[model samples]
Target: MHQHDRKIRTIGLADVSEPGDEALITPEVSAALATATDIVGYAPYVTRVQPRDGLTLHPSDNRVELQRAGEALRLAAEGRHVVVVSSGDPGVFAMASAVFEALEDAPQWQDLSIRVLPGVTAMLAAAASAGAPLGHDFCAINLSDNLKPWPLIEKRLRLAAEADFAIAMYNPRSASRPDGFARTLEILKEAGCGERIVIFARAVSTPDQRIETVELRDARPDMADMRTLVIVGNSATRRVGRWVYAPRQVR
Candidate 1:
């Protein structure tokens, strides 16, 4: 019923760890935003986007990934250039999957132009801030129990520990579930990983950023927050000068 005749285009934008890393936004993402007709994301994230004359910003509450994704797709279907913003790499526990899920429910938007622009992820940024704790085999886990059960999270922690994989934990602690991370530490300790090097990288790439290195046994649950990305280094992870990294070889 609308008068527009342009092809629908929905560009999903992945974001950096925090606003302090705005300089790290890829050139491709910046270009896409330049022509974006609408930007949709969590309130704080949408605030990161500079306002313009021809653009509309849709800010929503947290935990509404599917709703937000649908809104973006609907906007695009109306011939508006939509950009759905997410934290870190969208493909990595971000908006990309949610958007696709929405698309699956609405086949009308299937033919619309859809693309995901990558950005700096907190895990990689955290790993880099502490040299290369993930230089060896590694895995990233979201400690939040929003989508998955706590028992499953515990099981993965145990398995990852048994595999001797350097683990990067996302959303390690939150106000609503402060004890989740505390239990995570306990599980890791029970799995005989008490001696592993643990890195608490919070607000990385930001002015308030803090990267702390400590042994797993010494790492406190309070050391992490919702903004923190915790990386548990493997047995080979060690401190070189002031940097902590997993050695390239493990023989």
Candidate 2:
């Protein structure tokens, strides 16, 4: 038997918990790292994986998800066990979908074995730190217009507001697109969400973490950056002893 055929080169997608929070690493993810021949991902996430003698880390710039996914697939095809790392759960606004998208475009990669090991997503972590503001009905929306159109985002935001769902926003503001979040806040105000509670959870689970809650009317675009997770509570969301939560009952 060929040496390559003797070992299976399955590609593993590993998710890491927020920075400075080692306790959140799942057992499965920790186990997978022991066998990873190569780890691929954005620089920040890839840096989280400890360097070992046999492991090779390939860190790339942000916004190159497709290229990164393709590189991981190619490495796996070469009989190397590879892990594509993401900050949160791989499936939630992360590398899992990008890898699948790359696979779809390259039918030759369809047979490659791939597994997504889940982790605690950012919103959930943020919600937990804020005392369950998402206890009631809620929806998560990516506010980045890089892939989707702005009108579609606006439409969804308006509809979500109309439905009275708590809105968990990802990629709310970045240096490149500072104005988008400002517009988002304006739209929410127009939707009569001004008095609602808004939480900006920045760098959650990290040493520099900061969680701030304010009324939507008082929220400013400057309060959030790319690293922040912005959560807008529904009509009934309230604060109790420095924590915000949505009461289970209506009326």
List candidate 2 segments past 4 Å from native. Answer: 1-18
Worst 10 residues of 2 by lDDT: 5-14
**Which residue pairs collide, candidate 1?**
none
Q: Indicate which candidate wins on TM-score.
A: 1
- Model 1 is weakest, by summed lDDT over 10 consecutive residues, at 3-12
Give the per-residue lDDT of model 2 (tens digit) for 32-103: 778888889889877888998999999999999999988988888788888888877788888889988888
lDDT of 1 by residue, 1-251 (tens): 34333333333344435565766677788888888888988888888889999999999999999999899888888888888887776678888888889999999778877878877777888888889998999998988899999999999999999999999999988889979999999999999999999999988888888999999999998999878889999988999998998999989
User: Candidate 2 local accuracy as lDDT?
Assistant: 0.85
RMSD of 2: 2.7
Pairs clashing in candidate 2? none
Per-candidate TM-scores read 0.94, 0.92
